[model samples]
Target: MSDLPPSVRRLADGLRRLPGIGARNAQRMAIAVLRAREGWPEELADAIRAARGNVRPCGRCGFFAEGDALCEICRDPKRDGAVLCVVETANDVLPIERAGVFRGRYHCLGGKLSPIHNVGPDDLAIGALLGRVRDEGPAEVVMALGTDVEGETTSLYIAQQLRSLSVRVTRPAMGLPMGGSLDVADALTLGRALQHRQDVGA
Candidate 1:
């Protein structure tokens, strides 16, 4: 490595750990930080530290929350509790929310089922999801996961587990491409897909 200061090297190393950030991008980011105005890096560091310290999983929906209980969306009285949208991660929730088409609550599965990665039902918060469905008594659970094999497996698992429940389970219409992620989908496409969701069988 070049003769960069230890602090700069450490920052680059930390940045490299982030998803999609390679060594070159990490080095660029570290240099950018060094060139920033005074206190910028400190502010960024404080924000990252504070977020890590304060954020915790929502006890009800598995979304990130400031406390040990429900997230802001789950706690909102205006949101419809009768309909629940199931997503793969906390980040997936934002894009769906930004679509402004879904007014129901959400259940974050944390991740999809990937046999290759050894991520099974036990690895996810599936039990919590079933419990939420039982308690909330939602009319429908919308599977808003990607169209990949893992996503399909997860959706099927949820459907099977909830078969005994009175609530119906649905999925988005076949507009989204296979293996596509919701986070990168356009608002219009997501909104339309949500509006035309189809029912799933037990």
Candidate 2:
């Protein structure tokens, strides 16, 4: 590392900040970027800047949207408005969609409650979700979150918050392993879980 040029070192450091990228992997990626065709690095930078500038979270569901527009799912008329699937992050929505079992709308919580990490109800999209439930009058809101401790806590909190509403709060069943997150679940597993969701008492 001491022998590396300052620019290369900086690139490696920046790559290292990505999730699951260790020091060795970041260095390899940085080297690969440097060795690519002459214009690739600039193209990559331009693409990144474009996406960062043009993409934003959907106002209704927290999923990826272009500018102020709704996400594709939110715009689709075929989706069922009677149900809403709630997840932890925008990325988590992909695996569930890939499962092709849920045709309802979605709500991304941004993250779960984690006292150790100083995350609370206010830090998430819980308030928006409650407002949606109240206004939209969905018959069901699936808590399609992880099965970890924080996930359970967040689900319970949301369920309690919606206690006065007529909406039924439920969670996926059977297929997912304990402590598993929605993003890591396979399509088959997610589909089965959604098909067998059980009621959760608030």
Candidate 3:
């Protein structure tokens, strides 16, 4: 805002850069941060700094990890290693985990194929996924990507690549919106979708 001081304006600008945060929300956040209890800002800054400095992608799954270690899901021996759930981003994993239906491990692709956006297979974790499938020989792979055009393209490409393998390929059922992302789906919807997944003919 033109009337706001430079410091507050800068804080609002930074907050506005976050997903789904608009101008009004950014201003409110800036005001809240400025008016918070003593030392709260320092604590928030420290937390952000620590997470940024320490968090890294899992070596196998591309999910969030700490330094060189694997993610919690990848390290869990109780999880089903024979089934891998593939998704567009690390954020997509949380909703499925919250749904509590899939006991399998995950593989984040970082992003889907988007020619307009210049995102291709090489830009994602497809190679690593193929290598894992070849080495580990998973029984199944669930393509839990979005139903958008880019997502469809990526899924088809992956399925084509995996066609030579013996594993079965499937996708979440029709309950999920035709063009929606996994992150926006509610737990109940995600659970139901996973429970009724359909074959991809891979």
Q: Please give the RMSD of candidate 1 to the true structure.
A: 6.8
Model 2: weakest 10-residue lDDT segment is 1-10
As for model 3, its CA RMSD to the true structure in angstroms is 6.7
Q: List the residue pairs that clash in candidate 2.
A: none
Candidate 1 regions with alpha-carbon error over 4 angstroms: 176-202
lDDT of 2 by residue, 10-60 (tens): 999999999999999999999999899789889989999999999999999
Candidate 2: regions farther than 4 A off: 175-202
User: What does candidate 1's lDDT look like per residue over 1-202, in tens digits?
Assistant: 5678999999999999999999999999999999988898899899999999989988888788995767999889999988999999999999998989999999998999998998989989899888888888999999999977889889998999999998899987765566999988888778877877767782
> CA shift at 41, candidate 2, in angstroms?
2.3
lDDT of 2 at 148: 85
Q: For candidate 3, give the lDDT of residue 139.
A: 97
TM-score of predicted structure 2:
0.79
lDDT of prediction 1 = 0.90
CA shift at 174, candidate 1, in angstroms? 0.8
Candidate 3, superposed: residue stretches over 4 Å from native:
176-202
The TM-score values for the models, in the order shown, are 0.79, 0.79, 0.81
